[model samples]
Target: MSKSATIYRMVMDGHICPWGLKSLHVLRSNGFAVDDRWLATRSETDAFKEQHGVTTTPQVFIDGQRIGGHDDLLRYLGKPVRDPEALTYAPVVAIFAMAAFMALAAHWVVAGTLFSVLAAEWFIAFSMCLLALQKLRDVESFATQFLGYDLLAQRWVPYARLYPWLEGLAGVLMIAGALHWLSVPVALFIGSIGAVSVFYAVYIQKRELKCACVGGNSNVPLGFVSLTENLMMIAMALWMVAKPQLL
Candidate 1:
């Protein structure tokens, strides 16, 4: 068996190929000797592709057998594939994680302590603020997508546009520990509406649609995760209303 590999990759002065560099790195890291062949011009690159009958760049050959391109090389080495289009809960997880950390930090700064019921309140409030900010980044797009599932947004078109700002205001007020009368009712109303809408859309209607939660472009499904988000808001609202003693 041959222990050597040759890579045909584009490497012009102004345009260095990323996959070519990756291929070289992978080969070297795996203790394989590499014959570096640079297609330095468009004509040379075209000719190389034509000769190999492959459509893409950074072609690798090991022991005179075609081992294919960058992704193929990773597969050959038994590495995990990182598909860009793969759906994940990573974004929501990251957002909540950051919100929790921020809540703890804020609590520590204000009260000179860590982790209390107030800290939990702050966490939810911060999460709401962050989520609202994400939606507000492109409110028009968010409103357009939200109309697909949100019952209120469907009837009152202006509600979709106003929703993010309302969420943000309620969150900010909660963080300030002020205007409970306004914030509590706002949170309860919105959260209740959101929960019912999500339930009806996912369970009753059985619609397979992307959630406008997080952002308009998010791939998050309109289901349990979304319902949980709304439920959290409702719980927070109720907690605020019932816990005047805690305050």
Candidate 2:
């Protein structure tokens, strides 16, 4: 005899609640025989909400005890609840992972090979452009956060504002394999400053702060990941200058 659960979710001709679907999936995956109840129309959904005193749909009941929505269900099952505002490295990790994947794919598409020295170059360039785009979404916010610890940004406020654009442009040019004259110098300059600033702030001053690497509204902590971005740019810039001659 499997455990029995009842779920009330919205399902209409024109619209379906995604959370409702997720709840149903979770219930089934947990080995529950679910009595899936549907609120087929807005009026019915409203009526259900009024009757149950819940503002949202996909309410679950297990063994006659009411469990709230998705988050509530997770809690009931002793699972970790999702917290969007918590400090996390998820954004940077995702960007780096995707950039590496795309770099390999791009190299394969262009050069008819799955692996190459060039893929590493593309990975850094792609990561830089993506990270810059995140900062570009709210330049003012990013600048304010950046000014907290960047040595050059502390002395010159305008550099904080201009950093994202420089990074983006350099990354774009590097990806295109054009304007080595411009991109190489830009990457080297910013990367050098950023590396030094991060090193001093984190290692020397030993200050803990939020990184503006992801964006202005980012919750990522400043440390190894932030330093890695600058180090990658410096190495990439040096490679751009040297690879041409060595190849």
Give the top-scoring candidate (lDDT).
2
Candidate 2 is scored at a TM of 0.85
TM-score of 1: 0.80
- Encode model 1's per-residue lDDT on 1-247: one tens digit a residue: 4479999999998999999999999999998889999999999999988988999999999888999999999999899877876666777888899999999998999899988989999999999999899899999988988999999989999999998988898899998989999999999888999999999999999998888888787777788988988898899899988898765
**Pairs of colliding residues, candidate 2:** none
- Name the regions of candidate 2 deviating beyond 4 angstroms: 10-16, 39-50, 53-56, 244-247
The worst-scoring run of ten residues by lDDT in candidate 2 lies at 77-86
Error of 1 at 190 (Å): 2.2
Pairs that clash in candidate 1: none
Clashes of each: 0, 0
- What's the residue-level lDDT of 97 in candidate 2? 95
lDDT scores in order: 0.90, 0.93
